[model samples]
Target: MIRFLTYPLVILFLILTAVQVPQVFTNALASWQIYTPLIGGVLGYFVLSIIPFVSRNREHMITFSHEMTHWVFSLLFFRKLYSFQVESDNTGSITHSGGRIGEMFISLSPYCVPLFTVILLLVRHMVSRDYLVGFDVALGVTLGFHIGCFINYTGLYQSDIRNVGIFRSLVFIIGFWLFFAILILLSLKSDMYVACKGIFLRYWDTLVSFWQFVKGLL
Candidate 1:
């Protein structure tokens, strides 16, 4: 049961990052309206996916947050921590004999926490007007999180479950495609900074609450 959800989520993330292939090339060819940043993001995601070893050794602060969800839940439920393995394929998993809810929580933790963090960072970058820093930080943080998850937790090395599953994979692909599409469209007609500010303001409260919660944990 846990496998059902876990596999699909990982697969979805993989697909989301992988599906930018055509868009990447198309934008590259049309250098006049180049979506270089978007292309770079897509390429960066792919590079991380292909080269698992690179992501394995790097430190991912966000994973600390993500894994904490699992760790905390496990302890709350009084589940034993059996073993921690970081696989070559770039996924980490914690094995225990039982505890259904605990396993489910561990599997789903990334979606709630890591995804939110990635979105927040992306929005921040879009609104900042500091294009170089914004792009690099957003790309680096987002990619780092994904790579970190793959390398440190999901056990993508020894298992084929690195990619989540078909349905979730499609969702991730579509989600990223839409995200970049909107970003590119906004770039063409309006100042990205203004647009990003609008989004940031809309979600400011939620972001603040999330940060506060994280702070409390710290």
Candidate 2:
């Protein structure tokens, strides 16, 4: 019952975010080319992923990353945390007080988002353009780390996805990732700000047109 209901709600949430978050972003990058320093970061991330195959602590680190992401999302959603721990058996958990919706978001966030990636991206903003070389490297590294972690975590047993139902989880994940990606791009490319505004308008128009089409049949 709750699972089925969450489907439409997830769609509505995505539609709402798609129509709104892009509005506040007043910047965009001139180009999407991968900068050289970003390659450094990417390489670092790739190396880390491969190293895990031979490392003894890889499982523990991944578990820690997963749990830490939960904690981060908990904090972001205004949740109060009473405890968090990572066990030697490569298991971890967090106890936090939050709304049901917030709890749902917290559980699934790590799967779609790499907390470290966001942290590095945020840190990149603080550095000057003159120093962006280093920042880009860090960005690539974090991006790669996100990719690696996402790949590893997706197949393993995930309580988050099961709780929401896989179909709904995938829908929400797509929406969440799309929203964040657009937001990030818009924040970098100010020139596209106007186009960004038009984007959701077109999307809404399409939805409205579809609804009308459906109604004409009935």
Candidate 3:
């Protein structure tokens, strides 16, 4: 029942994100101070990816991050985390008990959340202004790793997407990716509060325009 109701919201979210694409890209491209390091980080991932050792070892990071995301969301929803395990083959599992909504989040979050990015964002203020570019480089590297691994990990056959339904999962993931990208760009320009406010205003404006379009159709 909840899933049924969630479909429209997810679709609407996708639409709202799509509408904000211009602004997000504009913001992202506007600052060389931000984008330069980010691009360097992304390129660093690609360079590391070509190395046999780094490529092989990355499985551990990927699997750990995947299951950890599940575990973290499980905690967020106050679910008990049971056994967590990562295999030698770049596969992992997290057992947690939770409500249906929480279950959905736990299952699907790793695909969209970028766990390391969140960690960096939290501790970002700790770094001095001079080393901020270094931090952004790290951010970019993690983002590159996440994007690279996400493509390698998630798919139609994956239990997480299958359990949630593929269409819904894709919509949810894409929406969150755009949403997070906007947040990341905004963060580059301003503080967290301002970034959040920017997101809210963008979403609110898009929602209002959408509402008016629907009313006109009616």
Candidate 4:
């Protein structure tokens, strides 16, 4: 019941977030501090792609990250993880106790959340400003790794997507992916609180404008 009802809201979330991309890009580019790491991350992604040995070795890491994301979310929802396995073929699985609502978050989160990237972001706060450029480069590398893995592995045929329903999975995946990506970009300019506030305020303004437009249509 609740699962079914969330579909529309997820779609609306996607639409609203998509509309913010241009403004996010403009702000990200306006500062070298922000754009430098963005460039580094892009380069890091390509570097990972072009090196066959490195890419192959990183497969296990990608698979582990995916399953770990499931495990983490499951724990958040108080579900017990019974088993976790990463296979040689670059695929993995987690067997966990689940509720109907929890399944949606646990199953779909790997596609939306980049665990390693989040870890790297957390690490950023601990580093001294003197080495931030280098640290940001490393952060970029992890993010690049995340984006590359997501592109290569995610598909309509994926069990995670199928389990949650394809349309809903895609809406949550793309929407939250963009949401997190934008937050990450915004973080380059300020701390997480400020970044989140900025994005949410923008979202609120957009939502209000949308409501006004809908009212005008009648």
lDDT (0 to 1) per candidate:
0.50, 0.70, 0.84, 0.83
Question: Using TM-score as the measure, what is the rank order of every candidate, best first?
Answer: 3, 4, 2, 1
Q: Name the candidate that leads on TM-score.
A: 3
RMSD of 1: 12.7
TM per prediction: 0.33, 0.70, 0.91, 0.88
**31-89 per-residue lDDT for model 2 (tens digits):** 54534565577787677656746356777877888889999889989989999999999
For each of the candidates, give the backbone clash count. 22, 12, 0, 0
Whole-model lDDT, candidate 3?
A: 0.84
lDDT of 3 by residue, 75-178 (tens): 99999878999998877898877686666778889999888887887777678899989998999899898898788888898889999999999999999988
Order the numbered candidates by lDDT, best leading: 3, 4, 2, 1
List clashing residue pairs in candidate 3. none
For residues 1-218, write the lDDT of model 4, one tens digit per residue: 88878888889889889999988878777875655865787687777667888866787888898899999999999998899999999878889885866778888888888787677766566788898888778778877887877898789999889978988998899999999889888877765667778888988999999899999999
The candidate with the higher TM-score, 1 or 4, is: 4
Candidate 4 to truth, TM: 0.88
List the candidate 2 regions with Cα displacement exceeding 4 Å: 1-5, 12-30, 34-36, 51-54, 184-218
lDDT of 1 by residue, 1-218 (tens): 67566556655444443444455346546663334454465466656655667545544434445555556556767888887655544445666556655454444445433453345544544564656544644554464455455445443232222334435433543454444444443443344566545434534554566689999999
lDDT of candidate model 2 versus the reference: 0.70
Q: Identify the superior model by TM-score, candidate 2 or candidate 3.
A: 3
Position 16, candidate 3: lDDT: 83
